[model samples]
Target chain A: MTKMTMVEALNLAMRQEMEKDDRVIILGEDVGVDGGVFRVTDSLISTFGEQRVVDTPLAESGIIGTSIGMAVYGLRPVCEIQFSGFSYYIFHQLEAHAARLRHRSQGRFHVPLVVRTPCGGGVRALEHHSESREAYYAHTPGVKMVIPSGPRNARALLVSAIRDPDPVVFFEPKALYRAFREEVPEEEESMPLGQPQLVREGDDVTIISYGAMMVPVLEAADSLKEKDGIVAEIIDLLTISPLDDTLIASSVQKTGRAVVVHEAPRSFGPGAELVARLVEKSFYYLEAPVKRVTGYDIVYPLFAREKAYMPDTGKIVQAVKETLEV
Target chain B: MPRSEIELPYRIEYLSILDENGNLDKELEPDIPDDILVKLHREMLSGRRFDERMLNLQRQGRIGTFPPIKGQEASQLGAVATLKNSDWMVPAFREALAEFWRGKPRENFILFYGGYDEGGAVEEGRNDLPVAIPVGSQMLHAVGIGMGIQYRRKDDVVMTFFGDGATSEGDFHEALNFAGVFQAPVIFICQNNQWAISVPRSRQTHAKTLAQKALAHGLPGIQVDGNDVLAVYAAAREAVERARTGKGPTLIECFTYRMSLHTTADDPKKYRSEDEVKEWEKRDPIPRFQAYLTQKGLLTDEVVEQLEADIAQEIQGAIDRAEKLMAREVDPLDMFNHTFAELPPSLILQRQEAELDLSLRKEEDRHD
Candidate 1:
């Protein structure tokens, strides 16, 4: 085991996969010589050379669209969009071709492609760099949407995403890129996509979150235990789209209260889907209405108001307290 | 120092073999075998017949809306003829004739138009992508396939078809640029069929020729008489050879006409003049190709009559088979089947709900 940041872990995952399988190819803007903007793919071009570690032209749609073709043509292409904001250019390709290819072909062709993009707000970045729009990909049916919280699981989930037979939109929370380190295994390790990891086990309240939001959720859980004498169960939702309803429903059923935390906006977001599922599955066991601690409905503010926009440990603790009271 | 002008020495070539009046430029005619030449003519005629039948079916409210491939048979068939069975054909929506020639079952097209997901299913081992409906999307797929071929060290090239309007799309430029950079073995055949629904080719772009757009992407480009089968076939063959020899991609612009409505649902009278349509009618691909075949003693009046009769029968048989297959009630469960290789727990539950809902409906129907 080695203690590494999320970026290193992700790099190790790609390196391991590419070393193991010649079919795996990495392509994106500056993914080659410059490694990546975040250096997640640092020094990969030297190891795999330019063919496997490709530096593509600055076209997001072309990157993903070509990846789709390569996937269909029997090459496992992991394409990187510079940022999640730039991903909008590839949305039509993702939605129209990537998502529909398997369904449209009716099992004749399947796209086993992975699109990795950095998301979430923190560290005072540019306008489009910080927003979490995972709901866009999660809403897409054929495509799998996964967001890893930390280094250890990021490595594991990325391996799984690469191996997944269908298209996977793997969102790496930029905020967590170097925020912390975890002891990732040297040998191969993978966590299944649809299963949420129960990070903390408690009886009072369940806190469900993913990606960078897990930081605040964990903080809130600790502070709640120390200050308010309330125990909280933490579920890091690795995969957003599949939304491990079994885990969420069972946890919510046990606690009878829940707070769903995410950095995405409140309106028509993944939180709504989680709340709806909680209502449908564990309504009889509920002691309180499920509260969502998420970004506001308005646009993700610039740096001046960015901290205010994101859900913090304080807000999360408060939401948990409110849910407990109800 | 005085500034000197820098000139890029490049000229886009144009190709024409068979003329409008059933005349062939003898020197430029392709050296195709007699048997393959007969097969090409048959496929072209079959495509025309299929289009006519599909139009009739649409008028009778039997099939859903689809684009008609009229007046562009040579552009579709001729280019496809150059491709080997191992080579990939990534196509935009208007390549039904090409798809048919590439061993895709005729029933698939009928079933697709008849609104069945089963329609999209190509048989195993066919190197053809399902028709991409969005304009210019399949070009990237072709390049990617070419990249994969290069990666695998395979000799198979890819042939992708799009329209003149597709040249304006960012994907087209990106695909071309990538193809050039990677030196991917891809043949990009642009079927410049003179119209994109209500808009004509003039409004689509200001470039003198769509073929010239390839110059910006660092690839060879040529304009061919799209209605001339011999010209399209010759150009595609050259492009295919260039790609197969690892010389990278080439862009072949087949300049043709969309001699029918853009789709069965469209009204050409609103956008185009009758004079333009009549002028193109004189250059119909089928007759010109037939004339060339007749000159070679490969086709006579009796042979033409018999071929038409046989094609009519074949088309009718295909329609009958498709109608019979679709007559059976499709399982609603099939809708949730293909989205993933293994159904997730969430989808599994949804599938159960759907099953229960369907059963309840059956019960309600029984009570009624």
Candidate 2:
């Protein structure tokens, strides 16, 4: 095991996958000689040559459209969008071709494609660089949307996304790219695509979150335990789509109260889906209404107002307490 | 101060081996086997017959709306004739004839227009991509497949087909740019049918020739008489050879006309004139090719009769088969299939809910 950040863990996953499978290829703008904008694919060009680590021309639709073609042609292509905001240019290709290719062809062809882009706020970056828009991909049918909170899960889930048969949109939390480090195993390890991991088991209320918000969620759980004498169950929802709901439903059933947290806007966000699922699966078991601490419906604010836009520890703690009140 | 004109590397060329009067430029004619020429003529004829039959079927409500491949048969079948079985054919919606020439069954097209998911199921080992309905989207896939072929050091090239209006799309430029940058062995065939639904080709782009659009991306570009089978075949053959030998990508714009509506649902009378349609009818590919083949002693009146009869029987057989397939009770649950390799738990629950809903509906229907 070695201590690595999320960026290093993701790079290691791509390296290991490429080494094991000759069909695996990495391509995007500046992904080759210049590594990547965020340096997530650093030093990969030297190891895999330009053929496998291709530096494509700067066009989002072209990168993804060509990647879909490569995947359909029996090559495992992992493409990168410079940022999550740039992903809008690729949504047409994603929705029309990548997401629908398998179902459109009735299993005649499938896209073994992985699209990795850094998302979420708190990096104090330029406009369009921040924002968590997992809802767009999660709402798309025949596409898998996965977000990893930390280094360990990021590495394992990225490997799983690479091996998945369908197209997978992997949103790497830009905030967590180097925020912390974890001891990631050097050997091959992969978590299932849709299974949520229970980081903490408690009885008072279930605190469910994913991606970069898990940092504040963890801090709030600790604060709730020490200050309020309330132990909160923590669930990290790695895969937003295909939400196994098994863990969330059972966790909510046990806790009888739940608080969901995310960095995306509150309206029609992943938090809404979690709350709806809880109401459906564990309605009778509920002690109080499920609360959500999420970003506002307005545009993701600039760095000056980033704090007020994101769901921090204080907001999560307050939401959890609100769920526990009744 | 006077500025000197910059000398460009490429000069776009126009090719026309056969004229509207069935006259061929003997020196420019490609040396093709007599049997293959006959096959090409037969396939073009079959494509025309298929279009006529499909139109009648749609009028009778036998199939859903589909784009008609009239007047563009030579552009499609002739270009596709240059492809070997090992090469790939990435197609947009209007390349049904090309797909048929590449070994896709006629019934598949019928099934697709009939709105069945099984229609898009390409058999294993065929390198053909399913017909992409979105305009210009399949071109990038062709470039990607070429990239894969280059990586494997294979000689097989990829040929993709799209319409003239697709040139306006960003994907069109992006696909051409990447193909040129990567030196991917891909032949882009733009069938300039002169119309994108209600919009005319002139409105699609300001460029004088769609073929010249490739020059901006550093690729060879050429224009051809799309109605002339000899011209399209020759250009496709040259492009295929160039790509096969790793000379990089080329763009061939076959200037054709939309003799029919853009689709079954479109009304050409609303936007186009009858005089223009008549002008293009004089240059229709089939009769021109037929007259040329007959003059060369390669075709006879008896052969024409025999070929038409064969095409009729084949299309009738396909229609009957599609009708039989359509008669079967469609499984509602089949919609949930093929979204993923394995159904996730969420999908499993949704499928179960659908199944239970169907069973409960059946019970209610029995009581009613």
Candidate 3:
């Protein structure tokens, strides 16, 4: 066991998978000599050789489109889009081809591909570099979308994504890449996708959040327990698509109150869907209306307004307290 | 303006094996067997007949909207007819003729357009891709497959077909560049059929020729007379051989024309002139090949009659096989099947909800 950042965990997951499966390959800009823009694929080329770790041209459309082809041709190509903000250029290939291959082929073929990209804003990168657009991929029915809040789970879910028989969009929260470290075991742990993890247990109110937002939600949980004696149940909604309604509903049903938190815009974001599922399944059990603390519905703005737009611990605690009061 | 740069790039040669009057150029002609030429003619004629019948199928409300493959058969069939059994074929929407030549049953197209789930499956055991609708996307996939072959050190080559308008897409250059840099075993064949849904070739790009676009990516590019089947076959065969030998990719620009509307729903008269249509009619692929076969004494009146009857019989059999698939009879739930290898829990829940909704609708219909 060793302490590893999300970046190291990601590299380890791919390295392990590639070591196990000869078909696994990494293709992306600067993935070879530079080890990717965020070093998520550090030293992969030297370890696996250039044949397995390919540094591609600065073309998102080609990276995704060709990866789809490779996936169809029986290669498990884990493509790095570098940034989720730039993934829009390959949306046509993703939605029209990669996502639909299985259904279109009537089970004859599948796109066993993993698209990993840095997602959301906190580090305040330049234009078209930071975005929380997991909603877009999650909305795409065939693409299983997974975002990691911490290092260990990131490695586990990535291993699951690589071996899965369909396309997966893996978003590693850029803010959480190097935020902290945890003991990630060398042995691969395969966490089935579409399942949320109950990070903390409580009976008062369930705080549902995932990815970087888990940080502030946990902080709010700590503060609420200390000052107000409000033991908030915290659930990390790891898999954005195919959400774990069973886990979410059971937690909210027990608590009888819910607060959804995310850094994405409040409108139609994953928080909206989580709240909807809660209302549908845990409606009768709910004691108070479910609340959401999220970013404002606006393009991720510059650094000054960035933090203002994102929900913080104070805002989350305020929402949780409001729900608890009702 | 910035100071002039060095010489831009090398311009490759254009190849034409048959004259406009269907006279073969002895020096440039490829030595294909006589029986293969006859088979080529029969397939080309059947493809034209199929195109004509498909239009009738759409108008008769038997099938949905379609893209006609008229005037582009030489570029499509000639290229596909050269494929080895292990080679892969990546095609676009206007590739039914090529698909047909490569063993895709007519019902495959019929069921695909009729909206059946199984229609998109490439014929069992075949390496051909499904009909991709997104323009210019398959080019990149072909490069990837080629790269995979190179990595595995396989002798098999990848063949991808696109159109003139696709050259303007960014993926076109990216695919070509990657194919060049990686020395991937891939053959790129573009059916530069004069019009992309009424946008003339002149409007698509300022470059003198679409073949020249490959030069910037450091690949060989050749322009061939697309209506001359012999020329198209020679160019495709050469390119396929080059790729198989690990010489990397080659781009073949088949200079042809789209004689019909882009699709059954389109009206080419809205953008193109009658004079241009009449001029391209002289270069129609079927007639040009028929003329050469006639001059070779291989196409007599009796032989022509027998060929037409055989193709007509084959087409009737295909139609009979396709008549079983009905648009309104398909199950709505079939949409969720094969979405994943095993239905994930979320989709299982969604599918259950959809079933419940359908039952409710049926109950309401019973009341009505």
Off by over 4 Å in 2: A1-326
Of 2 and 3, which scores higher on lDDT?
Answer: 2
Computed on C-alphas against the true complex, the DockQ of each candidate is: 0.02, 0.02, 0.02
Off by over 4 Å in 3: A1-326, B1-10
How would you encode candidate 1's per-residue C-alpha lDDT over A1-326 as one tens digit per residue? 89999999999999999999999999986677667767888899999998999876545777898999999999999999878987887999899998899889999999999999999988554346678999999999898999999999999999999999999999999999999999999999998988888999999999999999999899889989998999999998899987779988899999999999998977688999999999998999999889888775554544434554567777787789988887
TM-score on B-chain, cand. 3: 0.95
Name the runs in model 1 displaced over 4 angstroms. Answer: A1-326, B1-10
| Residue B363 Cα positional deviation in candidate 2, in Å, after optimal superposition | 2.5
Residue lDDT tens for model 1, B1-368:
87988664456999999998987788998899998899999999999999999999878867766789999999989999999999999998899999999999898888877656678898899999998765676799999999999999999999999998677668899999999999999999999998766556875677899999888888999999999999999999999999999998999999999999776756676557899999999989999889889998999999999999999999999999999887777675565556667877756765565465456546646976
lDDT of 3 by residue, B1-368 (tens): 88986775456788888867777799998988899899899888998898898899878877666789898888888888888878889997898888887788888777666534456677677888887665677889998988888788889998899998778668788899999899888889999988766456775677889898888888889999999999999989999888888788899999999988777766666557899999999878887788888888889889999989999999888887777654335565655666568877766665564455455556646976
Per-residue lDDT tens digits for candidate 2, residues B1-368, read 77989777788999999899888899998888899899999999999999999999888877767789999999998899999999999998898989888888888787777766577788888899988765667799999999999999999999999998678668899999999999999999999999776456775677789999989999999999999989999999999999999999999999998899777866676557899999999999999899989998999999999999999999999888877877887675665667678877766765565465456556646976
Clashing pairs in 1: none
Residues A78-138 of candidate 2: C-alpha lDDT, one tens digit per residue: 9998788878879999999999988889999999999999999886543466878999999
Q: Native contact fraction of candidate 1? A: 0.00
lDDT of 1 at B353: 51
